[model samples]
Target chain A: MIALYTALITGAIMAGLQAASAAPPGGEFPSKVPVPADNPMTPRKIHLGKQLYFDPRLSLSGDVSCDTCHNVAGNGSDGLPLSFGVLGRVDRPRHAPTVFNSAFNTVQFWDGRAKSLEDQAKGPLLNPIEMGMPSSGAIVKRLAGIPGYRREFARVFGGKTPITFEHVVQAIATYERTLVTPDSPYDRYLKGDKNALDKSAKQGMHEVSDLGCASCHAGAMFDNPGLPMGTGWFRKFPMIPTNPTCATYVREYHLADDPGRFDVTHKQSDEHVFKVPSLRNVAVLAPYFQNGSVGSLRTAVRVMAACQLGKTLTGLQTTNIVAFLNSLTGKFPVETMPHLPETPDSTSMMQVAKLQQNQRQLN
Target chain B: MIALYTALITGAIMAGLQAASAAPPGGEFPSKVPVPADNPMTPRKIHLGKQLYFDPRLSLSGDVSCDTCHNVAGNGSDGLPLSFGVLGRVDRPRHAPTVFNSAFNTVQFWDGRAKSLEDQAKGPLLNPIEMGMPSSGAIVKRLAGIPGYRREFARVFGGKTPITFEHVVQAIATYERTLVTPDSPYDRYLKGDKNALDKSAKQGMHEVSDLGCASCHAGAMFDNPGLPMGTGWFRKFPMIPTNPTCATYVREYHLADDPGRFDVTHKQSDEHVFKVPSLRNVAVLAPYFQNGSVGSLRTAVRVMAACQLGKTLTGLQTTNIVAFLNSLTGKFPVETMPHLPETPDSTSMMQVAKLQQNQRQLN
Candidate 1:
């Protein structure tokens, strides 16, 4: 497909082909989202997952849902620098990453701690500050008591007592799988449409490719380049930390505050190593980097150029790259609000929350 | 329409008609919502309202939108008893009423402090424990900074400075005017469908109407009986506090704890007085009453019967009434998630929140 697309392109723009060829050539977004064989994608399961994703009852305070942070209403990530958890009780350290097209990521989470969307799904629910559901058994009991969910779980999974924590994550992962964004402007350009991007954006695309930005941000997703699942495409954020200009950004943004993948692996080599992030929707996703310290896309581009490539981009170069990044914004699918099911007689969501606490104590 | 539907019914059920005649006759939910003449409804305005309704930027925490509490996805009310404010720092005393069909109420809020939906819209934006926008000017300034919202407001309202506090409420109220729940089973029955309700529910319907529940829970909306806007249909909960059965409920649920209308009006007669709430989706709205003391619909019905009507209903009566209330569950319109407008370049929602705080302090 790449060869065919390349054949269609005029040779006049082949100045950066040598550099792009050394890196992986961009590919089209897959029409179908990849799903694990263990958790096959069924429409009912997806529907159930949508309900669960929107249902705030899963949280300790019963107000924060997956949509509360990674809201699908706009860019998947909430526009806030940091997302607040249940009842807005505690602040999460990192910005909640955009869930849009997250299924395509080889590993989930900024640290690449969770191998897949399923693993990522469970992390927040049990996380003390995020969803905060105490124990897995408590989640099962809490959901099972909701008459609407109980019936749904039975219908979807087709077994008695089907509302298990495993199925909960499974269903959510299935739903997240459907959140792929396709037909971005850059994609159209790669598909042989010369006019897809603005003149500046086209120049920026060539500039980035020639600068070897594609070496890390490769393939269609721009994060993982044909890496197997569980094999993280990890890269050190400040690749050229010794560079004078890079050291300035490192301090200003508190880039080294987090140990990154080292927090999970507990290894010196993994220090400051993080999953290569997708550039899709980066235009609207402001307050860039893991810590959400930077504010503008233009500034982020400049910072990245300095910190990673050890080259301070000129004003025109930064503008061009920003234009290029803006073209990655794609058409987001319409999110329809699902009718979440009702809890059993008279047991307010508050009581259920207390029940979770009690169950946690027992466990 | 009521007379026509009444004629369709057999004369066999005239036993309770005499008692019901003293109260308001049941009517079908109106196809249209009442809008103040001053604030006309428009599609563009409604669309803008939807964006604002879901935008968390209105809050001090920049995470609590109108939809955060009075969620329209399910019962319109969050299943929790009390809603938390910014950062979950404080708990609101009263239950956040369902926004569905709220436009039909003659007065807004449990205490009837706000005269109309437009007035109600303004209350939460600046309330320290709610949306927490500092002042009216701050709200205008906060919204004006967003480039997309600036464009949208200009298009919708058509002025150089279109993003005003008044216009914000106008758009939100206009959008809220569409949140009526119709085509309920009870509504179908009111439209002359004989089999719309089950036998038990039918019996329960007659029981409530004859028992004088209609005096307050009247008209198409079941909360205002042809009353002029701003004329609250206020009623004292636990009306006959002297009755032995009523005293038990009043004591157990702390029914008289709140000063209610007295809090707003400071009148002797207004003690424990509250605007009559609609029973439209009461089945799904658990943790009932102003304080959410009663958990189940059945228990709430029993409590209401005892406190308001001064009658200790039998289990069968409670069951029947609960079933009847369940039949009022209407077909909720599909809430389409609107693409909330993006904030300008690098301003994280967090920064906007801080601006609101500074504006508050300045005010």
Candidate 2:
């Protein structure tokens, strides 16, 4: 079974590689994002997923949702250096990546631990420091208990028993896949509209390739595609050891302690090796970098140049890059908050009882 | 100045009283909610307030916003018995009241501590257990520092300097006044639509007046107009001392310790007295009552009947009342999440520095 699963994944990666090769120069992003074969995107699934994304009942405290960290209003990021989770837990070690156009990425997370969006959706629910659901079983039980959710799951999946953890993650992933942001100024420029980008942004686009940023940020998503899906193309951050910019970030933001992918791989070479984040909508989504150390995009550009390329960019060069990055800000879809279904008496009555019991203990 | 302010307030109250008496039988809710003369609702102010309402930067933790608790999607309540506040503080003593139709209330808070929505808005910002901002000065400074907010405040207030605490509360209150839910089945019935309510609901509506429920729940907003605006019409909860339902609630939910209005007034008669809540959208906004002890609408009906009227209602009577309460579910305006303005580096860079300093101290 493991071998068969491996073969299927390998086949998918090969197909993705072929598609990558056919991509236009500077990597013209596809207008429509691809959906996984196992979980086909449907209106019912997407609707259900959207409700789930905004619903905080998935958390133990009932105060955090997927939208809590990746707010749909602000470029799919919380605009915090580190995100606050359930019950105002603010010690998150890494920055939340933008959910916009995240479907184009090979892997999810700064360390690329989760292979797919479906897989990534499950991590936060069970993570003690995140949404703080006791278990997958607990989440399933909670959803099953809520009559609205049970009905939604049944309608979406179309089965006698469809309220499962797998369906929950699948639906959420399907909704996320539809969050692809296209038609940015950069994208329009690639589509033969020369005037789409301003003069400064055009110059910065050329500088992007000239400065070897395209070597890694190569695809339509400005994401590395050489690596297989669910696998990361890890690059050692702060490659120039003597760079003052790197030293300052390490000292101030406490970035040196986090071993990046080495936490996942447990290998020396993987130390300081972090996943290359997509630069889509990077302008509005601040503070920058994995640790959220850099507050300003201009400063971030200078630091990236110094640490990654071992070159100090001129003030004009940094300004132009910042302008080009701003051009990547695409039109966000008008997302009205979904009216969540209420928990029925059978479920909520028990919840109230439990809540009372907890309250009593505290008092 | 105090006499002038008093005269102005008295005039407004008299006008409100006249309006209340002019309402038709069954108390038909007005189409347009009354706007306070001092803080007349303006499009620009409402727009700015909407952005601020959704922005988490107002909170000390940058997590909890007004929308976090009073979510527009779910009857303007979090659907939790007690709301979780900053840093997962779940010890909130009372249920979060629905923001919908709140403009109708004579006073704000269960204890009637705040006279207006403007006054109420200020309480949570500085409440150590709520949004947990250090001070109103801190919030003002934060808003003034943000270029977007500064520009918006200027535009809205039509002044060079507009980002004041008074303006902030005024804007928020103005936005909240617009949240009045009208045009329910009950309102339609009041407007001479004979067939608006079904037989059971019709019976319940008749019982509402016959059983003396309308004595407290009077006027177009189904609020007691005898009590002046921002003044409490305090009623002792669980009026029947020997009721089993009251005993169970007091024991289980710890309702006895709250001391409702007594906490504010510190008077013997005020003990256990609470501001009578509006029944608008009551069916959907559950678990019911201020303590949130009763989960089911039917159960709530029974408890209220026994506690307030000193009558143990039959199952049929309770069911009918529940049906009638369901008729109060009004048409909710489609509220799309407003696009919050981003804080420029001139503002956020300083915030980040402070955040890092705090984090360093914690570490």
Q: Which structure among the candidates has the greatest DockQ?
A: 1
**Model 1 agreement with the true structure over B1-363: per-residue lDDT tens digits:** 001122212222332444443322456666666667778788999999989988888887788889987898867887776676676644435778999988777789999999888889898888877888779998888788788988989999996679888899989988898887889998777656879999899888878887878777876667766666677898998688888887887787778888899999899999989999988888888878897767778778877887788888988888888888888888889988899877636463647434433323421
Work out the TM-score per prediction.
0.91, 0.88
Task: Please provide, for model 2 over A218-247, each residue's C-alpha lDDT reduced to its tens digit, 9 standing for 90 to 100.
Answer: 555666744446667668886675788677
Chain A accuracy as TM-score for every candidate? 0.89, 0.88
Residue A153, candidate 2: alpha-carbon lDDT: 93
Residue pairs in collision within model 1 = A346-B295, A346-B296
Q: CA lDDT of B297 in candidate 2?
A: 76
> Each candidate: fraction of true contacts kept?
0.49, 0.27
- DockQ of each candidate relative to the true complex: 0.39, 0.29
